[model samples]
Structures are given as C-alpha cells and as structure tokens.
Target: MFWKDKYEVGVELIDNQHKELFNRVEDFLKVIRSTTLGEKKAQKVNETLEFMKAYVVEHFRDEEEYQLKIGYPDYEKHKQIHDNMVSFVLEVSEEYEKSGYNDALIQKFAGRLLTWLINHVAAEDQKIADYAAKREGI
Candidate 1:
C-alpha cells in the first residue's frame, strides 16, 4: 500500500519510521510476487521475515511511547492492539520456521500484515494524530 502524506502525525521520527515501514513492506510484497524461483525467492523471503520480526516490535514500541507521551486517552487500548499484532507475528514466524519455511505460511503472513498495517495506520492510528493535532491547536 502507498504511504500517503496524510499518514504523517507531525512527529518527524514517527513519520519517517512509518515511511520506512511502508518501503520495507513493499519490498516484502515484491519478494513474494517475484518469479525468481527456487532458493533465490526463499532467500529473499527469509531475509524479509527476519527483518520484520525485529523491526515490527521496534516500531510498535516507538509508536506506543508516542501515544503515551501525548497522553492519548486510548493509549491502553492502542497498546493492546499492538501487543496482539506482535503476538500474532511471533506465533506465525515460529510456525513458519518450524514448518521449514512454508511458502503458504509466509504468503498468508504478508497478506495479513498488509491488511493490518493499512487498517491500523489509516484508522486506529489516525486517532492519535487527531488527538495530537487538537491538543496543539493544529
């Protein structure tokens, strides 16, 4: 999915991280859709999976900290959402590895990750932006 300017939250660090997130996810999508075949494709998938495992947790931590900094009323609930997503990612990652890098598992992961990121940023995350803006009279 495209990273629109509207997704920016007036926080340079967070906005940059979000943009990088979109780029990484797009790379993941390309690797999945590429027709390279054999180990080459699997290699890229493995690389992306490894990057995402840590990157996602880092991003969520930063995002949650931002929410708490601004005293967002929904901080608790938002954190819960992040926690749930992280749990899902870890679970899937473990299963995917256990199954010897199953193609279907990663494919399913990419699809769900795409949907979750888009919806979370476009919907749930927008609330934080709105709250920040209103607080700052922006």
Candidate 2:
C-alpha cells in the first residue's frame, strides 16, 4: 500500500512509523506479485513477514502511547484492535509454518494485511487523530 499525505495526523513520530509501515507492506505486495516463485519469492516474503512481526508490535506500542498521552477515550478499544491483529499474525504465521510454507496461505495473509492496514489507518487511527486535534485545538 502507498502512503498518502492525507494519512498524516500531525504527529511526526506516528506519521513516520505509518509511512514506514505502508512502504514495507507495499514492498511485501511487490514480492508476492512478482513473476518469480518458490525460493526466490519465498525469501522476500519471509523477510517481510519477519519485519512485520516485530515492527507491528513496536508501532502499536507507540500508537497506544500516543493515545494515552492525548487521553484518547477509546484507548481500550483501540488496543483491542491492535491485539487482534497481533493474534491474527501469530496464528497465520504458525499455520503457514505447519502447512510447509503454503503459497495459498501466504497469499491470503497478504491480502488480509493489506485490507487491515488500510482500514486501521484510514478509519481507526483517524479517530485517535481527531480526538487529539480537538483536545489540542488544532
């Protein structure tokens, strides 16, 4: 997915992290859509998956911190969304491993990641931004 300027929430740290996430996800999609298959594609996919596994947790932590700092009332609900995503990623990673690195599983995982990231940033994260803006009178 591409990061658009409109996605910015006037929070430099969070905005940078969000941009990095979009870049990583876009790179991941490129690998998945590449003509090459098997080991070559799998290598890139594995790298991206590993990055996502770690980066997502870090990003969520930072985002949650921002929410708390702003006294965002929906902090719990926002956290639940992050927790669910973490769980989904872990579950899918385990299933992918058990399935012997099945291509189909990876494809499905990528598709869901794309959709989830978009909605989370565009819909969910925006709510946090709106709350911050109102409080800051920005």
Candidate 3:
C-alpha cells in the first residue's frame, strides 16, 4: 500500500488512477520478489508491463486534460515529464522483450517504477493540487 491519502492530487480521476498505479506497481514488486517459478513470474511480469503501458498513457492523458482545463501554469513542463516517462516505459518494455523477459531487468525496472511513482505522486502531482486549491480558495 504505497499510496497515501497525502499523495492525492484532489482530483477524483487522477487520484484514482494514481492509486491504481501504486497497486499495479506494488503487485509487480511482489511478483518479482516471490518464490513463484521463473516461467510464471515472467508471464505475470509481461502482463503487468503491458497493462502499465496502456494505463499510464490513459492516465496521463486524463491528467493533462485536467491541467489544460484549469490552465495550470506548469502544464507544458508536467506533460513533458509524462512524455518522458512514457518513452521510458516503452523503451524498457522493448528491452525486456529483447532480453527474453529477463528477471534482472524487470527487477530493476520495478524498483525504478516504484520510486518514480512515489516521487511523482507525492511531489510533482502535489503541485497541481496546491495550485488548484489556491485558485479555488479551498
């Protein structure tokens, strides 16, 4: 349960997506760390990776839309961050496939993913919430 109430961006859609991301990444970590057989673990990892690719894109799209709606001052910078992450995920997935679903690569990817999610939700996304709050005088 890496997700915390404090990490919420005060937007229902984005907050829910954040929670889902946390859950997915946490599941990924558990799978990689488990005593599951190598084949099963690799299969699960591949599934998770595919899900993340699609879900992350959808979530970012929605979040960016919200930013645009509110005229968030950092929209461009924030979107660039999202774009970079998407590219990273795509690049990693490609590498993971090329490596024949190597365990070491996925293990490393999971760690980085968790760290990025936590930082983005708790810090970067918080800025959006704060800006929205101030604008609304909430």
Candidate 4:
C-alpha cells in the first residue's frame, strides 16, 4: 500500500523489490507500535532489523546493476547515494546493538528511513525511468 504509481521505475524487478521493502517497513512499524512484553518483542524487532540490513544491500546492488546496464549517466552519483544509505544503516544497526536494542534508536531510524525511501523512489529513482523513456522516444 505504500507504493504509488509515481514511484514506478519501469523496471519490474526493482519495482517489486521496492514493494517488498515497503511491506517490510510496514511490518516493522507495526512491531514498533505493539505493546508485546518480554522476549517476543525483542525477537520481532531483531528480525525486522536484520531483514532490512540485508535486503537494502541486495536491492541497492541490483538497482545499481540495472543503471549500469542502461548506461545511466548519473550512475556514479546514484551509487554514492546507495553507499551513503548503506553506511547509515550499518551505523544505526551498530548503535542499536550497542544500546541493547533500544526502541528509541530504531524509532529515529524509521523516521529517517521512511523519508529517504519516499524521496529516493519518487524523485531519484524516477529520474532513471524518465531517462529510459526519453531514450526510447516514448
């Protein structure tokens, strides 16, 4: 439900991955708001955290590959953006672990993440689609 037609990059695999990422983020938000007690709460949070760390890296790699395949002129800049996000995720993950899986930390992370995802997909990624369309004379 977080996906919008405006965010479509005209790439099936990447678009599907974006949807899955949104779904996972939704699930994470649900878990965050839940009042579950004890280890069950920690377990769910940990699972979502692990999933995001891995999935984002994989998704970025695939997206970068697609950009390279099409010879996107801004591929280098885009990859830099991807790297920055990965670094941020890792830094937050480390802080979360060091702080004993603090919910406050993840709450802040979620806010920044949602903002970045929306902007990246709706603006940055859309640039690729726009370029491709123009290239094809669509």
Best by TM-score: 3
Instruction: Report the C-alpha lDDT of model 4 over 29-133, residue by residue, as the tens digit.
Output: 777777765566677668867887999999999999999888899999999999998888888888878887677787888888888988999999999999888
Please, what are the lDDT tens digits per residue for candidate 2 over residues 1-138? 478887888799999999998998898888788776657777876787788889999999999998999899999999999999999898887786677567788889889999998889988999988888899896
lDDT of 3 by residue, 3-77 (tens): 899998889999999999998888878878988567778888888889989999999999999999988999999
RMSD of each: 1.5, 1.4, 1.2, 1.6
Best by lDDT: 3
TM-score of 3: 0.95
Give per-residue lDDT, candidate 2, residue 119: 86
lDDT against true structure, model 3: 0.89
Candidate 2, position 97, lDDT = 66
Show model 1 residue runs off by greater than 4 Å.
Answer: none
What overall lDDT goes with each candidate model? 0.84, 0.87, 0.89, 0.85
The better candidate by TM-score, 3 or 4, is 3
Q: Please give the range of 10 consecutive residues that has the lowest summed lDDT in model 4.
A: 36-45
